[model samples]
Target chain A: MIENRPLLNLISHLTLCLGVLVVAFPIWIAFVASTHAPEALNSGTVPLWPGDRFLLNYAMALGLETGQKTLNVNLISMLGNSLVMALGITIGKLLISMLAAYAIVFFRFRFRMLSFWLIFITLMLPVEVRIMPTFEVVADLGMLNSYSGLILPLIASATATFLFRQFFLTVPHELIEAARMDGAGPIRFFIDILLPLSRTNLAALFVIMFIYGWNQYLWPLLITTDEHYYTVVMSIQRMLSVGDAEVAWHLVMPSTLMAMLPPVLVVILMQRLFIKGLVETEK
Target chain B: MMSNLSLANIGKTYPNGHQAIHSLNLDVEPGELIVLVGPSGCGKSSLLRMIAGLETITDGELHIGEQQVNRLEPAQRDIAMVFQNYALYPHMSVFDNMAYGLRNRRTPKAQIRQQVESTAEMLQLEQLLERKPRQLSGGQRQRVAMGRAIVRQPKVFLFDEPLSNLDAKLRGQMRIEIKRLQRRLNTTTVYVTHDQTEAMTLADRLVVMNAGRAEQIGSPLDVYHRPQTPFVAGFIGSSSMNFITGRLDHHQLQLGELRIPLKQKVDFNGEVIVGLRPEHLHRGTDYPHRIELDVSLLEQLGADTLVHGKVPGLDQELIVRLKGAAPCEPGTRLSLGFHCDELHLFCANSQQRIN
Candidate 1:
């Protein structure tokens, strides 16, 4: 990269193109296949280009038009449920983590580090490991098949809390003292000073937690049996498990592409703040 | 309005059992500026924080005006502090930063704006009011920090090394600005700095601290002329006051073979540490006693020169500050003369000044 020789540039550009193809080829194949008729896909030769039924396949996938043996479950409502659960989880995680990190970093109390470590150790006990107990608790609270049930169990993230704690630690002690001199009490300091200072961090965490929430599969699948509560990811499983019937490749491909859009948009929208949050050196 | 501030037996001991400040006391009349000057870990900053109510007083009473503020929160103490790093709220605009305390106190909206604008104008930060702290230069940020403190009109203005973060030129400028602001406001101020020049130039009454104790408290000139402890004598001047072990037999102070006849009578005399200010020594036969110095090093500071060398009988290096450059080089012998009254004598063991 330091040398600007034409041959070197050509070679590097060719290698980059190859890398892109390696990563993007599968997505391209899915997009192309989603536009084709189900009949076109069953022929065993994959289509590499656009087909005539682009609108037809997408319409069926969105539950706007019904095809033969189409998915009886509503795709639009499933997408809505996914959005709600994703938003809820992202917001829930950010709020809980920010407060926990604030308490851990700013206040001095007995067993403070012990409580932080207790939260940190939960990183190892993700929802998969504590599935039964989490499910029992959700049921006991009568929250099964609800947005709270989908979000609450998965919202307490140690990584995000640790990140905020590290950021808060880097904030100079003079700032806290200055705020105290300005007559700002604890909650006032947190809101006026700490919150605005953490704008980029909040944006970055929102994107990450949003994607994390949107892609949740096992947790939703385990808890949500009601079709009204079905997330797009869990519904995809139901789509594929139509009792030994040949899976709807055309419908599934379009829905898969749709499922990836919200997270991609989130990343794109918050790309600037995300990078700033991750790499900022200034307070 | 100005209010007198007093500290009675102020002390601080960390929970880890490290005693940072021993029993210390000071009083400041209304509109007076008191400076706490000491080296690091001398508990100067800790003492200031205690006054501002940012740090809890371990065992003492602090009074601002008529109120005992020992257990009060910083907000309730009615004091403002300008930190070493200027500690302006990085996220808030300069105007908002200045107005924050006023707003917090539930001051009327129009009044807060008026106070902030006037403070900004006084600090010459009117144009920079909409800018954030990071957007401004170091001096501007420093002015904004001062502006923040001024807007509050607190009982006492506590500055914790406010100029230590600036470049030399900017620091000098801000030092003057801070003194002027404090004077115009006529508030009782407690300023802390390790810089001897800042302490000497700005303090109305200087407290020279050592090992968490107030070694001396007086006007800058009074402390300079009459240092009660060896630490104050050593700490006040630009270069330290040179100390040479000598014997005091009656009126004759002896450094090996050289005898300096004392003009005043002394009651206690024996092994004594003689302190000499470099500026008080001259390089000619103008005074009562003359000592020949073998020059070792020369520091030419343009305005003045420091001649570091050793006298024939004294084993320790003798530093003499001369106007402009000295004509002597290394290994050359220079004749230096000093007045008898210029000699500062202390007990060798106790390190207390011998009056």
Candidate 2:
């Protein structure tokens, strides 16, 4: 911006285009494969162009009765499960983390710092590291095939809580004092002032957390054994496992595209707020 | 309705055992504006906060309207505060900001609307009622803050250096606006500021604080003319009061080789400090007490000229404020006269005014 350099701009644009193509190449391949029949992709090297079976493949993937039957679950039900799990995780995490951060930052109770640090320590332990014990706890609690089993364990992470705590600390102390002088109690202050001020952070975190919940492969695969509890993301694996024969690449590709659709749509729709939230929260 | 507020031997010591405010006692009459003026860390703000119930009193009792409010919360204390930063809710509109208190108190919706509209009209913030705080200028934000406090209709108003954040011109304008508003409302108010000019202009009674203690409390002119302690004398006036150490002998004060007769006889005569205000020192040779000073620096402010110099044979520098411009170059000698009654005498050790 400071100096107009044509060659530098050219190089930058070229690099960006290359990065975009590299990222978009796989999705394009998936789309092409989904449009073709199983016989077209069974030969050496997958087809890179669409065939006449575009409507047939998507309809079979979405319909109750289809050409390939690896799993008994329908595409609509799997999509519904994914949507529910993502919404549950996003809302649950936001609720619990905001309350925890509020209590830790505003209240003067004993062991407040200890509690904050205990929550902060959870950042070091990802779900992948504690999957076995978490799954066992879910099974013991009989929440294995429910939405709570898919959402609650993932909501226990400290990232959102820490972000909220950092944000709450940056809010001017004078605002809190003024609210107190205005006859607003703690609940009123949180509802009237704190929540509205945190709108951008909430939106940004929603985008991240929704994608996190939607793209969960290992957790959903390990927890849900029932066909009705299958998320679109985990159902892709079930379609791939065709037992002692060639896999149904066409069906698997369409389901993969379906699994990736909602989160991609969310990111695209809230791109402005997502970018603003990300930048502001880092401050 | 207005109510008298009193602090009886109030004090604050932090948990770490650092005492920020000494036992401070003051009786604020109803509808009076008391300005607490001091340097930073002098506990003026702490005293204001304690009176507002934002800070706990570690020592004594606070009474508002004949009720002991030591254990009450800030909201229950019936006091509204205008903070230095304005503290306007960035997310709320100006109307919402002003109406927040009444809403919290569960006032009827119709009443809240009427009160907010009236207060906003008073502050001239009606046009900005729908705009957020961030959309307003510094002066507008300040008015919104005042509107927020005014809508509450509390018994007392607390201001913690509210004008410290504005620019010089806006501060002057807002100072007059605040004084006028307070006069119209007639609410018992406690305002805090480190700037003495603001304290002098806005306060009905000024409390000059130093080192966590009130050095003097009186009307602005009374404190300026008759300061009780050396700290009060030095802090109240601009450009500072010059003090000269000399020996008091019988009825005469001996300044090295210069001898000046005292109009009144004093009992104690060993060592004393003579205080002289800059404005009191006139550029003439006719007055009873005259001294020749070797001019060191001259600052020409359009309305008045500040002469910084030293008395002959004295190492201490003395400043004289002369009306209009006096184009006297440095290293020249000038004879200045001051009245005998204008001299302030303090004990050399205790720094307490003697005569």
Q: Across all candidates, what is each one's fraction of true contacts kept?
A: 0.86, 0.86
Q: Mark the 10 consecutive residues where model 1 chain A has the least summed lDDT.
A: A64-73
Local distance difference test scores for all models: 0.90, 0.90
lDDT of 1 by residue, B55-170 (tens): 88998888999999999999898899889898888888998999998988999999999899888888888899899888999889888888899899888899999998899998
Alpha carbon deviation, residue B86, candidate 1 (Å): 1.0
Please state how well chain A of candidate 2 matches the true chain A, as a TM-score.
0.94
How well does model 2 score by local distance difference test?
0.90
lDDT of 1: 0.90
lDDT, candidate 2, B1-355, per-residue tens: 6899999999999999999999989999999999999999999999999998889999999999989999999999999999999998988889999988898899999999999999988989889999988788999999999999999999999999999899999999999999999999999999999999999999999999998999999999999998988888999899899988888888788887778888877776889888899999987677897888899999999999999999877768999999988768899999888887898888898888878
Report chain A TM-scores, every model: 0.94, 0.94
Error of 2 at A27 (Å): 1.0
lDDT of 2 by residue, A1-283 (tens): 4979999999999999999999999999999998998888998787878888887788777874554553345888999999999999998999999999999999999999999999999899989999889988999999989888888898865999999998999999999999999888899999999999999999988999999989888999999888888899888777777688888777778888888889999999989998998787421
